[model samples]
Target: MNRFMQALGLSGNSGRGKAELGRMAGASLQETAALYPFALLAAVYVLGTSPLGLLLLAGGFHYAGTLAGDRQSRAGGSRLLLPALTAAAMAAGILAFGLRPAGAAGAAALLAAAVRGLITGRKRLWTGVQIPLPLWGIALSVILYVYIAGSNPPALTPHRTELYVLCMTNLFVLLLRWNTDQVRSASPSYEVDGQTASRIAAVNRRLTWLTLIPIVLIGAWQGFGPLLLRLARWLISLLQSSSIPAEPPKQEESLAAAELRHMAKEEIGGTPLWLTILGYTLLALLSAVIAAGVAVLLYKLLSKWLPERLRLWVRGLLQRFRRLRAIRRAPGEQAEYLDEVERIEGVPPKRWRRRRPDGKRQYAGDDPRQAYRQLIARAMKRGFVFRTSRTPSENGTELETGGRYTDYSPEEVRQLIARYNEDRYGRR
Candidate 1:
């Protein structure tokens, strides 16, 4: 045993040992890949541009989803085509949108990998339903951007920005369904039979509900959005200001060119460069604070509404107010009485009981001393003190035999014992 323990705790760094570790890690990666073919797409999305980035995010979610499904079914296959096609389409979109060639190709390769997984049936990805992590990242981005940028200027662009934000939001919902930890943890409360599928389904259902929550919250925030905008403008006015001075147009400029330069100079004078920088910086900071606050609030709200099993997990980490729901029984008189008797006797239920003729056993339903009283009464009637045997016997116990104990007991004691026995074990 000592040798086994030592072996279990041993560490090694030899070439052969390192090789084995590498092999193990490689095998694990391959297994993860076959299951979640689009897992690789996530990295690409973070590095890709606009549509390409968003597409990869979606692909990652779909891939994660396929993994969840495969895990649910316990079937193994490389279900990669959907994600790959989705990724490829996204790359094509990036190219169409005028992103550089290298970026587009990189995206295309990622999509191809997903496609390959789809075509192959050798590997499968599995995790219970989860919202993709990237989708959450995007939502965080949107919240931050809107809070900082508002409806115009450097942050909010043409209508495309809104469309992109909406797309990211949708992806967030899908990701939550496939990957959110809150949803996964909350599942056990609704799952009675302890089946994984039921837990997974319940988690998915919760994600569907939660996915819309952030959107709704942001929309509500927007109803009061103008107030925040005014506040931001006021703060911007306090920062340092800068302006570019105009130069004399000596000889070569045309009428139109000079007029344009004059307008440019006026615009530059109106908003200082330093002020602009400070404004953007302040906006970014405020946006960050707001996003963090919203995230915390959302987490708290969901944590409260979460099923008990999931709440336990959430509280285990947060150490927040934990609500433990116990089975609520009716006001039970019997339970109270039993508790009192046990407190007096210091004896447990298992220590007292005799098998009845009907194949049932009786113990202290309320009072523990009642058994002794009944035994004494039976002994008095039967003319002898019944032996208290450790083993079962056919005849009535010493208490049941009666007689001897009648003379032994004082009159007062006998009367009290008799009264108690009659009131208890008697017909009532």
Candidate 2:
């Protein structure tokens, strides 16, 4: 019994088990926070639709694929192929089960062609292909459910509510993913000073709050209005019309009969084809513009009115809520790494160096020129190559113009060079 308990990680003195549990808990919380909007939508959907098992299965596959892709990306390997294969396989399986054999084969062929087209040419296209895999998987799962439900002759009419929820949730997830990717790409990969990291975190938090507003609005619409339902219906009708048979009606059919048939089709569907397409196009554009404006205005207002202390508190709360600290590397590791890098570059260590009364580090000879040389050496370690014959000002200018340091601003580089020149050759 004791051995079994130990194997199950329930035994006392199991530090490894405890650490693994902590990691799992932290990952779970982070994922929950990241997908909170989708979770709420899923809950609403499951409560109304009663397709919990299918939804869970689809979500599980999607999460697994996404995690695989992210792992590959971090390792600087091909990131999209595995996700694409997983998503496509899941979609094909769902379609095969829910559709006629001919229809399933046709859809699978179409999906294969689309995936190939997306991933064939450029590296940039791989990312575009990978991002939509989860949404496509979820959409296919929903389609399978709707098809199954409609298989019953008495229940031929599709469930509009489930479709609406899927559309809204998919849109929200897409937006959230896009915003996250943008923020992540904008962030510097190298370690930064505390002030820079804090500023970046603040910007990310603000963007996150802005992104949530639209999702909240979507949730409200789901609860109180039929906007999403109507939109879904219109979109479905437009697609159906576009795929209509090219052959014309029989000449024997009376004009009134043909007109009545067309009207009946439109009524049964949702809206006239042209009007539906136009309305949705305009609606999408307007929503995008409004969301952008709202985000900008909210950011401006908060920056102007919110106190720093309150802002810090809010940031801290958000970090704790998301379990970010649990996932972040230890501060000691980061400090040690930075110190080691500085030592390798022949720069004085901040910790062991003597400090003046003004809190500035005192150089060995009490000369700012030597301090400037150390700073130049540090810059060299950061990829700023210096020529032995070049003067300090020339070296600084070359470094500034080279655009090697992606994390530093142009003005910051200019200012640093100016200070170095002033200390080295100008009146002090």
Candidate 3:
């Protein structure tokens, strides 16, 4: 009876554990899902109406979509592709619906949602479906103000509030998952295994290209966007002035003469905006270059004048830094072996053995092979035989060079043979 009761208890515990696991999985899916409606609204309100605002909204969605796609069970594509596709769909929907009559647009939106749902299925629909709601809310407010509430609403308007909300929602989602165990697990491995380290390095190099493109774009825009805009404005002004009829002075002979003078004046007075900006940019770049050159020169001078001890310290520090970088860059067991060698005490080749005066166990001689064996025995607390040689030539004489133990340099062998002969022949 006791055994049966114990088995029954164990079975109940196992069943409860499975039930709890199922509940947690369901909750996590729901949490991943809860933000779709708001995303849908944001999408509808922003695109086509506010160009920059639309871009910001798209960026936020792309970020959130990327995070979501990465977290999803089926990561079938690149982490960035899903988010990008979702943004594209949102943009398309806004352009399609926002430009149409309100009633017609509503039907179109419902149709689009249905079609999208069918094409991508319920999971992917929810994946991209939530972006239109906040967009709709902002669009509704704008459409109402433009058509009904105002006498003359501005043609250019942006749903700044909804854009802000969309950005915040995405930032929050990213932050929420930032602390997840999965993110920690996916981080580049520090103590990598197999080819994983090289793969990670390659991935990082590729991702660096992602950053480089944005940097180049920003650099060009900062250096040239304003210049181009100014040039366009100036060209428009020139055309406008050319189209205007100029009044002739009473003393002037002809209208053509007055027009030609006006043309010449305009030409003389008009500064090339591009050239002006280019000059300033060049000046700024030159100043930066000169400052950098001066700094480098000062550093060289200071290094030259520094105390010898200080220079040595700096050189040592630089070498240590280089060694550290090499260690960081090297692969495999070579690094570990170097680290072990650094940690252990030095045992020079020559002074490899020692013995106690009591001499319970003895060392034959200081030949490295014998010394190494002695050292090992001493380390392991084992006993070993000590052999002494005689035969003045074999032991310590100059002619002992051809002995079987003559692998050592002739001078070293001679020295060892001399010691052997001294000890053996002295007793003889």
Candidate 4:
């Protein structure tokens, strides 16, 4: 493997590329997904149509940006794909809005998301905690608004209200699942057999059904059928507005006034419009509060019922998967993967043997096989020109003569290079 890579590494680099290494492929799809919900919430603050299209466009662009950034981290990453991707995103935004009847605000949001996602990918910005930065601000604003100003944001329209309810519901579920994942991580001391693991999984499955059943029932009861559903919907419509807009439309005013007069029997019962409006508003708010509380209570019960042994089973399964993948990969890919692992960890994963004094597994080694790789990564980071024509020994000599790696003596560096050459070619 070393012989093949070394031969390839010496193949001169102007147009010819060198062996790619040290790719950090950061940010999982979930963590990246977590960012966009907040961006959607930010758009929700303006409140006309739901920014569903904007949300979808931004998410695709963000994922592409991260993928492109990951590729560009390797050798030949920046060749042509990045500029093309940026141009594609911009063109997509233009066509989506210009050809379609999409709003101007939504189009502007799409372009902003594309640029932001690209910068995030190229710079590989660390999202603070596991979520994005904007979530923190949005959360803080909500907290301040509720506690200090003393009211919820004014009047979400019917569609906006429905989406807000569902999205918030899903967010709580994701948050609970996230917490379960942390608790599910296997601790070193605990262990479980196959039967016990299966039983633990059964408990989790039951708990999931336990939570989901009530939520389904609640949605069905409120939203199902025609007669009762229509009456429920009428009450919802009454809550659709409280204080009319200052410069109210004439047609809308007449319809609302007619509806209120007929429903409350304003002439016969002599009820004021504001009093009827308050009653409808209170009914909707109370129903929403009760539903949210019940959902939360169900989640709590499910979370408490989870067992620790499930985490051990999960860990065993993951380790088995990793071992299987290692066995299946082609030889060259496997060698490069191991080398890349060593580059990131300072020691290859395959080399962990013996326990340190602290009882942790020790992986301390100074293998001279790493000399060439260390020198190349160091030179690249320090802005030296990359040339693959030089052998490992020649590269070390150049670095030394040019006053790089000054901490090591010339003779020590030379000796390390010698061992690398011997180990590299001795079999041949």
Candidate 5:
């Protein structure tokens, strides 16, 4: 783990800034490592029924992705074809086993890797949209299980440790998803500083805790589940019983009312169900009241009795915490402050030469297509229109022959467009 973080430039207080080809490869590898579990879950739980080969293939796929990222980093171009091609091959292999769904998922993963930062309609050379592919895979896995099993698996009791594992796994995946997005979408020139990194860490912790909310809610439901079900049945029975025509009357009361009376007297662990329910409800209410009172008392006591120096120190800590919280909320201020601080501290901002844009959404330093994009932007800026419908070659010829559009040589314009076309479409 330590070695992995170091390799990715994601270790210690200041590792994850200023995107480089090497760092990009390392980050891509980490994302793949995170993805390996998806294959495992599928093998163990997703209807592959424990195919060990999938895991090995997944590892190979990630290794390939890492290599592709590293190559692109060193090569100075936009071709990240290797990772995508590797994924396609994996998909094909999975399909050959007749596991169509798993094969489909692998194909989806391929697209997520391969088409990044490529021309896509209105947005030329745009990064692929980020999606929680693992989450989708999990959902699909469960759906497949349900379809194949004839009936859904038995309702899980809270005692199953795997449920908690799955929930925590869910939290982990979400955090990785967030971090991957953060790393990929950042500008090439951007550097992640200590405070920004800290803020990201804080958000990761918050998200990890966020998953606990649902787990806690689910746990709480266990206590209420039976009662709720009984009440629902009672209500449904009452609604249905009201219209019963041929029912024998018991003491001039309807069947539902009789059922209610019977339920009231029903024994739950040697105590009447109604009495047990009342006792639990009263206990809960009493506990809530006492807890609230204690909280209020603590607040009042702390405000009144805390020493002046301690109070000030606490307030300072709180202010610092608030600043941390505001990092994402008020990023503009944070950005300015960070830059200003870096300048004051005499730390030259570190930068890395990008081989080319890969899965990292950042535009690479020597990216072949970047120059063409600049030309397009400049053409738009000069109050003259380039024909959007025409190919780059056609547009270049039109500009050169038309003779009214440029301060530079018409031949230069033609050559520029030809080069742009060659890089954008002709280059493999």
Candidate 6:
């Protein structure tokens, strides 16, 4: 037990362990502080209202505002403000329109947040939003279904279908988010090579095509009219005729036995195939349309007013909250590579050429040759092999020819080689 406990500690020394523990505790506290508002809002939407719920709601809004303020500071953009306003608008929508409309508003707000995260390259923020958005969607669906079912018996079937649609839509949103992340991170820099660009473009096109399946399904449902009901009835009649015993269970049977038998026969035979297809296709199309619209709107907003306003507000907020100084620090991992690239670019071309002790010329000053070599090293780590005799450009050409570096292109390779060749041997 002592060994196990020691193993759990940071280096198993009380002083260092205590400091590490403190840091972990602080991080946990910060995370909880950030998340409590969303939790409270979720509770307000999911659980029945009470005085406590109202208090939580107020606290949640204030906390959300604080987070918005912090996010604005970090991204130099109005990262949080849009979502906060969106939430407020959604709440007002709930009051004015209805729960379903509010749910749509919530979805729009979530999509907007995701779009902002994607545009700003805030992977952590995007991922965090993705996790909760789906949960909230599912919870809202359940709550709405219950509310609708309780209010009117006849509405249950349609409401249930709507709930399924919502769930499917949520799933498609997740898929799109995943695909978008994949596309964005496909290359190391903003200027993706031709191959990487083509790959991303292809994936996006495939996603678009996949979207048509749902649209077609929805259209077919609209065109066909109640095919699911007809199919279900037909299946039920067939089952009743073939499987169910003509005679009722004997009186000697236990209540449990009779109930089980009845349930087995009565439970609507699994969802009709057509209904399943229709639900999925409609939901997918709905989700794709909403996500696409949100992405476009985000692009426009980022292109115009929001980013400047965010930077100003964040700068002011940072000045006021001196304690939140840590949030202002540059993200290390992301900046490190960018800094290296900038450093390489900052070097003068004349300084990049150096004569070796052996009288051979080489590219110096941490040039693109070094970056290309590093890329090769990384590829080796990922199980790619290159012959030592081959020059970096030759290897790059070989890789491109073999279709190995899907994330890079032959032109990019040639550019790197040209730079290297210029440094080694003066351009003719």
Best by lDDT: 4
- Using TM-score as the measure, what is the rank order of every candidate, best first? 4, 5, 1, 2, 6, 3
Q: How well does each candidate superpose onto the true structure, as a TM-score?
A: 0.30, 0.28, 0.21, 0.33, 0.31, 0.27
Q: Whose lDDT is higher: candidate 1's or candidate 5's?
A: 5
The C-alpha stretches of model 2 lying farther than 4 A from their native spots are: 1-52, 65-158, 189-205, 222-428
lDDT of each residue in 174-259, candidate 3, tens digit only: 22232232222455563345256545545654654564455346434532335555655565556556655666476846888878
- Which runs of model 3 end up more than 4 angstroms from their true locations? 1-100, 110-158, 178-428
Clashes of 3: 18
Whole-structure CA lDDT of model 3: 0.42
TM-score of 5: 0.31
lDDT per residue (tens digit) for residues 1-428 in model 1: 33432332212533333432332223223323232213223333333334335444444534443333333234443355365466555665465434766446545644554443342212332223222333454455555455435555442243333434444444443444334445446665533444564557566757666865665566545433564676567766654322334456668878989889889978875656667677777777887888887777566534545689977776665532211111133254432221111123355665544555553223334442564444444444656433322211212233234434433334334444454446554621
Q: In candidate 5, what are the lDDT values of residues 52-148, reduced to their tens digit?
A: 3654454445444544444444454354464556557666556644557756665554444433312121132112222344345445444443343
Most accurate candidate by TM-score? 4
> What does the lDDT read for residue 326 in candidate 6?
35
In model 1, state the lDDT of residue 14.
32
Lowest-scoring 10 consecutive residues by lDDT in candidate 1?
334-343
How far does residue 2 in candidate 3 sit from its true spot (Å)? 37
lDDT of 6 by residue, 269-366 (tens): 65556655655565556557768876664443243335787767765775556534434564754422111111223646665454456532233446
lDDT of each: 0.44, 0.48, 0.42, 0.49, 0.47, 0.48
Where is the poorest 10-residue window by lDDT in model 6? Answer: 335-344
Please give the distance, in angstroms, between residue 332's alpha carbon in candidate 2 and its true position after superposition: 60
